[model samples]
Target: MELKKVIILGTTQFSVMMCSILESEGYSVYAYSTYKEYLNSNFFMGCPVFLTEDLVELMGGVENFMILNTIGYSKLNTIRERTFADLKMREYDIMTFISQKANIYTDKIGQGCIVMPGCFIGNNIVLGESNVIYTNTVLTHDISIGAYNFIGANVVIGGNVTMDTNNFVGMNSVIKNRVSVGSYSIIGCGSNVIASIKSYSVYTGNPAVHKKNILDINSVNI
Candidate 1:
């Protein structure tokens, strides 16, 4: 019998990492993009590299492959969202990947999500589309996360927390229980968020404070 083909949408470290995960799950993996930086390579982590335009033909049509995006938190999740939307518009079979090494306790994860190894998704958590939860992250029970959110490694989101769309929670940050984080916000690394963060804002520090709105900030470290 032939194996199922999966075409990852980037050639970054995230894509490389996902290759191992996908292969372990008995899927044949490949990587491709229009970006020159990613296209510079002939193969990515043992998966053949191809141009985005040649994907359907190379794989013998869209029906022969499944798509997974690994754009990795660029432009506050908008770039990843755009990539996912493009594949969907092209009628590709985009898939959500939950690593076998992770512990999932919910069935509420939306399509196109990537839940990486060592992550713990607790019970009754609602995860919307295209969110990427990185390694070793802990999302406690009853949390609500909207679409296109990027959750970094080792981050811990407490129970009943609500995270809006296009938000980036940096590595090792801890969002307190019942805190509501608004859309398009950035919670910087190592933050201990105890309060609600407003939309389009940047918050950092131990007890996270409003640094500035995302629109006003020219650059973000995370």
Candidate 2:
């Protein structure tokens, strides 16, 4: 049997929780703390801890080490891109982490998919590559999410929901049962989606309405 070595960046409580999950899955974990206080915590006793600022210096010839970003923020796309770029330049393999407690009943979870703690996934959920599901995000039965989708924290997705590629679902957003969200669409934070959203649209507010076209804009923060 082969053993996987994973390195988690960011030394928050979330990082420790993820490390525990990975360790239970038979992966050797190294926790990187951005703050010195986190390094001294009892939660990281069994795992090797390092300073985030000194990653480049400490990563000497360590190939095939999976780096998981445990930072919780809305603007994660830019952060992920930057981190991946840096790791790639150094020839390190990047990896994603999904909690063992997550109720995943999917046929396949794509590469680079990160499922955070307290996430509840239902049966027959098909998720594409590079999708991130933050903490407490709930996807009911028969949900389908496309590639490069960012599902924010505490979002609730009802059963039979289909979301296309490159969609951004904001925090606390709720998608009603059987709703279909189109490609490149953006759901604003705290919005409630009750109907099918069109492609490249920006939907927001309670009972989500199509406010504008997100594709017209140059940049999305996430």
Candidate 3:
């Protein structure tokens, strides 16, 4: 049996991680980058870098390869979300990557999601499209996560929690059971979320509280 061909979209360090993982999964991995420097270099992480303009022709067609966006939590994940949307609009098949080391108990994952190694996804979880679940995160039973969310490493989301779209849950954070995290909210690293969060709010501290609305800020450093 022939291995599947995949084109990962990014030149970031995250792209290199995906390249290694995809190759381990029996994919003939290639990279696509908007960076002209990558084009001159010709390779990224041992995979050939294909230019954006020549991608379709080089791949023979969009049907010949799958696309996985390697954009991480930068810009509160607006860039990653937009890139996923653009790929969908262009009719490319987006890949959902669950690392072989991940322990998944549900089959309800959506398109373009990347579940990193050492993650544990429990029963009755619904993970939406283009979300990034970083290493060692635990999603307990009966949780619902929306599209474009960034769940950082070693975070523990308790059972029956509801997390909305485009939210950033920082590393080592603990979202208590049955808590509801609103859309566009930022749960700061190592915080303990004991209560329901409001939409667009920035939360931190032992028992997370609303710091400020995300829209009011000029930029978010998370």
Model 1, residue pairs in steric clash: none
Candidate 3 CA-lDDT value: 0.85
lDDT of 1 by residue, 1-222 (tens): 996677888878877778778888777775555544447777766657877756777778888878888887777878788877887787878889999889999999999999998999999999999999999999989999999999999999999999889899999999999989998889999999999999989899999999987774236446
Over 66-117, each residue of candidate 2 has an lDDT whose tens digit, in order, gives: 6776654334344544554555565655575677767777757876678877
Distance (Å) between predicted and true CA of 35, model 3? 6.9
* TM-score of each predicted structure versus truth: 0.90, 0.68, 0.91
Evaluate residue 102 in candidate 1 and report its C-alpha lDDT on the 0 to 100 scale: 95
The TM-score measured for candidate 2 stands at: 0.68
Candidate 2 lDDT for residue 175: 96
**Candidate 2 error regions (>4 Å):** 1-3, 8-63, 69-93, 215-217
RMSD of each: 2.2, 5.5, 2.2
Which candidate wins on TM-score? 3
* Candidate 2 lDDT (Cα, 0 to 1): 0.74
